[model samples]
Target: MDVRVTDDADVAGAADETRSLLAWLTQEDELRGRVTPQERPPVPGTLGPVLDGLVVALGSGGAVTGLTTAVVAWIRSRHSDVTVKATRSDGASLEISTKLVGPMTPQELRAFVTDSSRLLEGGQGGQGGPGPDGGAL
Candidate 1:
């Protein structure tokens, strides 16, 4: 998973905010054992270790769900105007991508992340349940 902030007046400050958000995410109970923050290489134009984004590795299949929810909620609360993108790959062909544009309540955040995760997993809110008229139940 990775998060980057865009459309901010202070580029450096935005980077700092991203770092702060990353720290908060790392501290979340949902991600405590499931996500690991990775060291970022220096940027080409930057002089030091300042980063515009953060990258974390998810531990298991379920980790993606937790990490995504945590990241979106964090960003929504901290920097509502900033754009954030979180990406996760399974070391093969599967990859999960999530984007947030602005502030979202916990309920909205959960719904968004759940929908995205479902799409990424090639499903829509898990297996289809019984529908009206008793068809495709």
Candidate 2:
């Protein structure tokens, strides 16, 4: 998932919104819950190097403010089997990038959440590419 925090001026608010969003996601049957950060090699390491993903923006109240172009780039690099893009809301003037990573199951979403959690706990966020076996996914 590519999440962006457009309003950096209010980092605390953004975090709050992130927490609320995560909570809401957990309650939803469709979305995979919160991202569980995993422990992997750091971004500087060679084995399973961490990839620089999109930056999610949090509003003053911790709500998702907006997304950026980086989100689109990250989605494209991570999920090659799918197509991703973003659009702006004319009324709200909010820019959001949506990436289609095929389809995400509840279980997969949970796994992603776990992986995200691990990343937050200092683990490598996303894999740069394929491994020795040429496994990208």
Candidate 3:
């Protein structure tokens, strides 16, 4: 999975922020060996060098759940608006926003997870629950 992180103009350190997120995920017991920094070609953006993205190795059963949980929590812990996009090799992907996940209810969160799991696991299309405001990819 290619995990991309983006932040608002006020927090233009998206690449740096992604690195921090990598650290956070690395510390999670469930995500320890699953998270690793990956490279993306530099683009014209103030976000800097395009030196971001985490290539998470997601296996079956609960792997997506733990990854998303850790990711959402990391986003919420931040003050700036940060968004995440998780995409599988099959091109199925989803994007979630910190603004959306911060106030999400359990049901909404479940929907996000269900939607994430489906995409991350190689499925595509309609989501079973309310998805993240960041929209689908």
User: Best-fitting candidate, measured by lDDT?
Assistant: 3
Each candidate's lDDT (Cα)? 0.48, 0.30, 0.68
Between candidates 1 and 2, the one scoring higher on TM-score is 1
Candidate 1, poorest ten consecutive residues by summed lDDT: 128-137
- Please give, for residues 2-118, the per-residue lDDT of candidate 2 as tens digits: 342231213335333334333433343332332222232554634563322223322222122112222323333332232221112211122212232224454543444343333
Candidate rank order under lDDT: 3, 1, 2
Clashing pairs in 1: 130-137
Q: What's the lDDT for residue 97 in model 2?
A: 21
**Could you estimate the TM-score for every candidate?**
0.55, 0.25, 0.72
User: Model 2: which ten-residue window has the lowest total lDDT?
Assistant: 84-93
Could you tell me the lDDT of residue 100 within candidate 1?
36
Candidate 1 lDDT over residue span 22-122, tens digit each: 67767877666443344456789857665545555444466556655665556556533554444334322222222332534556545666655443344
lDDT measured at residue 56 in model 2 versus the true structure, 0 to 100:
31
TM-score, prediction 2 = 0.25
What overall lDDT, based on C-alpha atoms, would model 1 receive against the true structure?
A: 0.48
Between prediction 1 and prediction 3, the one with superior lDDT is 3
